[model samples]
Target: MRKEIHLEHSSLKYPLPEQFVQELSEELAFMNEYPSGGSYKTLSAKLAEYTDIAPDCILPANGSDEVIESITRAFGNRLILIPIPTFSQYEVSAERNGLNKKFVPCLEGHNYRLVYCEEDLKKASLIWICNPNNPTGSSIPREEIKRVLDIAPGIVAVDECNYEYLGESVVDLIEQYPNLAISRSFSKNFGLAGLRLGFAVSSSKNIVEIARYGQHFRVNKMAERAGIKVLKYLDYFQNIWQEIARTRDFFIAGLKGLNIMVLPSKTNFVLVDFTTEEKARKIWNFLRGEKVFTVAGWEQEFSGLDNQYLRFTISNQEEMSFVLELLKRFPENTS
Candidate 1:
């Protein structure tokens, strides 16, 4: 069978281990009943140990998206503040829940620094921060995040879907700042995208609030088992981060050699700038013709921020080798 590669959505490029897949398959015998709280209880305990937070402080959801939606619902009265060119779900969740939103645009030019004046920061309630931000992969330092947490009177929520990749976590701050919530996903690190597993960490009081407004049974039995099983081999999952970093740097170096302006990223993907919207479109079209797909920087999710950029998830070197060969020609006939 030909190896089908996907460079979108930031799924681990590696294949799932057969042993883990078998464990989940064996769990199919129990589809008749609602997922027991016992599994949830056990998983919560496990995650508590993993996140260093008490079980009561953790709220499991179908995925990070659902957790975000619930948070938006719980705090719907507050005005939502989000940085542009981020995961669009924050905006979508706010719209779905009828929360008013204001986007703070990234500082003009390539850096995309998230800057807001005191008045801008004080306005409204919730602030959505995506660390190692999607598409651009630019990260805000811990001190900067802490500053936001201190200044914002409203809840300061963080989308940390790529947290495991870089070990940059504010989950530790949950105890100190009851107003902060960290959203995390197993889909990126554990290769469980299809399983749709994720959770949130916050003060126990906040967890109670999330449960108050969220779905009653957010996690399924299979997803619970899949997450628990994956945790058993946490070391294997952690190593994938290193492997991806190496592959990302290798590909980035090659792109730089070709004089394609690329941004610094700590996540599993990189943004390639082709200088003009038309040039970027040609590259996007060229890759599509090669049966490869990439996220156009002009997509609505990017809020039309980087029209000449493309978000390409870094797969393994073998798959990247194929992509690189095609990318080598991105400038040939288009000029």
Candidate 2:
């Protein structure tokens, strides 16, 4: 049987360092004890070292998902201004917390920029911006985010879950904008997606406010150990991140070479436009039959997309070349 190729979730194709297993093995003995609270002290200290921020400004969580939920629970009382064709979790969290939301048509004909009026900005109590956005894999600049921070009435949450791949951040803005909170994950760069380790970075007061909604001992012992262990190997992961970005560019080029329209991406995935929903679905079905999988645009739920674009996660060179070959074999414009 052919090996299954999963390019659905935009996770890193790289494996974790061997030292991670040894660290987790040592942690197994301490499974009986409760971990420190969600704002784990040791993990927070390490993250502070990595981010060059104060330890009090970090709120460690099970994953960025929990951080998103907590942000909504803590401050999602009024309307939330969400730019469409972005991550669905922002909307999911808003609905779960009973907050009214306004979706602005942002990504179409705009080079995937975040578009919203100052009136909407003033009325919003919370705003979610996914830097290096999901599905579309586009990024808005820090200045754009700074503009939102200036006018928004409440918390401005920036999801930097793909920051490692993009290599750009507004983390420094947290000190200047007390209402700014950034959520990051170890899942992508560190290959710890299954381990569920992520954190929120903000001003000390904002971190404290967000931590209230978190469950006591929410982070597992093993996950915490993995997070701390991985930070020591940033140099190793830095090299991997560069390689992944290069692979993503090459993959995008390969798709373009085949006359496919792919939105420029700063993340580990590309949004491929098949001109119409029919073509997108046909190729999607074809790839699945070949034991390859990708995320369909409609599957994203928040994209408000009708073209049914396909999002392909970039893998290693060999797998990417194989996918390119498969695309070459696909009979385009055939009934």
Candidate 3:
């Protein structure tokens, strides 16, 4: 049987908009026509309106990965700076491009949060940052982000895939800093992971350069309609996100009660350290036996965690409560 509880990956587990599902179904008629590729014009305008950025500065892609890949292709010739234990893909991308890469660890004992040294900041060409970072879920301060922009030697690519909960953004900095690009995802916030839709915000000149590597028939028509509906009822979506954040706090508190060490987070997930890699694997096995799914911290991207953590994506309160109950019954490791 399939896993009964899914706390794996950072994707939102709640249902997508009912109306969007209907619209996506009805809009399937446009399947015969080609997708607009990386330059979904109207969608770019919608993103621009939502972000308060210029349409010419936005590039809507099939997914945020496309936007990131475009960054690698456009600026792959230089050194790339990445924060360790954030997302593994940035390292993979850098390696694929044969670009020199540096993985800077955050301030000592900051739970793998982002911290940059001035000297290290001046040595790279492209800096990759994942706010409310993926595996760790640690949110770096806004001022620190501004500092990176001010000091970084070259382009800084900020992946704000989980940006909604922060209530503040450096996206506005894109216009002022031609060296910055902010990539956002609809998959997590809009509940559109199935569509694989995302967009990027940057200076007009920066986007123009990224768009040159953009290809055709990238975004599907149904996904486009769903994306439009999401923007149209954005307030409703925002409210839903607020609820998720509330649930996240509740889940963190519940985990703490179980003697688990949870990293602070402003995102929909939290990193729970089991104090040791062996303990983590034990709990992972216990949960897997119960058919609940979650991310084991052994992933190389999260090596900074020393395989001692688990990243649990938040679901509804009911689902979370059930998981917590199961975890309560977990045998304590005295090892």
Candidate 4:
């Protein structure tokens, strides 16, 4: 039996659109052709329509991870500043490029909120802020984001992978600050994780520079077709997002009922801190033994700081209920 339930992966638990699946099946014929180089013309235009940004301002990459790497490469040798316990990719990308990394812990005793000082921002050549931050699922307020932008002299990259869950965005601020860039992904809301599609929205100048670092025909041909198909079903995607938000809140409430300390989240997952590390580990093992996968806080190198902290993703109500029921019975396994 597999030792893990693979619950740490972030994406919708629901099915992809039937139309998208069907169209993708049909578009498999195009796999024989090479992907279009530079900006994906059709997909870029479709994204432009969705984001209300010019096509030239978008740069598509095989995945947002690649987009991050490209940004790190282009900037070259600037200090990368990040808030603690955010996405790991930012630090990993910086290390891979031999760039210095500075981490300022988010608001202590305040659930990891963005709390960097102006001096911190001034020293950074690139600042990566994950809106609706990963692992913690806490969002830095828009006003705080604006404050960071105002003081930072370098480029600011906002990773909005979970933005749809929050229903807010800073994309509008792009025009106001030439140094700001927004990275978005199709993996989360669009259910396109397997397709590995992501893009960056920024000033035309920045987009052009990032595009130069991107490999030719890097995006798979089939993924582009899938992207175009998914864009047409935007309504379906929106509906799914609403359902996810509803279920996520319901699940969070259930966790609270069980006395698990859940951090407030605008993202699709909850960060739960168990009262004791022993309890957290025992419950984590019990859930895995029951074939219900969840993320154990110890799985990541940075996670052990809080042995009680576990990250849980919201799927459907039924799954949430099962997880909650198991937690309610946690006392039985505590011995």
Best by lDDT: 2
Give the candidate number with the greatest TM-score: 2
Which ten contiguous residues of candidate 2 have the minimum total lDDT?
299-308
Q: What TM-score would candidate 3 get against the native? A: 0.94
- Quality of model 2 by C-alpha lDDT: 0.86
- Measured by C-alpha RMSD in angstroms, how accurate is candidate 2? 1.6
For residues 1-335, write the lDDT of model 4, one tens digit per residue: 63333456777787987867888898877777888767899989988888888898888889898888988877646688878777778887888888898877873653776777888789888888888888788887899889889999988899988888887899999999998988999988888888899999999999988887888886889888877778888899888888878888998888777667788888888877776788788778888887777776677634214667778888877777778887888784323
Error of 4 at 185 (Å): 0.3
What is candidate 3's lDDT per residue for 1-335, written digit by digit as tens? 54498888777777766776777788777888776665788888888888898888888877798888888778756678778777777877777777788878763554555677788778777888888777777787777788898998678888888888776678878767878998888888888887888887888888888887777656777777777777876777788788888888999899888877788888888888788888899889999899888887675645344587788998888888888888888868322
lDDT of 1 at 217: 70
Candidates 1 and 2, the one with greater TM-score: 2
Once fitted onto the true fold, the runs of candidate 3 whose alpha carbons sit more than 4 angstroms away are 1-3, 300-304, 333-335
Error of 4 at 115 (Å): 1.4
Clashes in each model (backbone N, CA, C under 3 Å)?
0, 0, 0, 0
Q: Name the lDDT value of residue 12 in candidate 4.
A: 73
Query: How does residue 187 of candidate 4 score in lDDT?
Result: 89
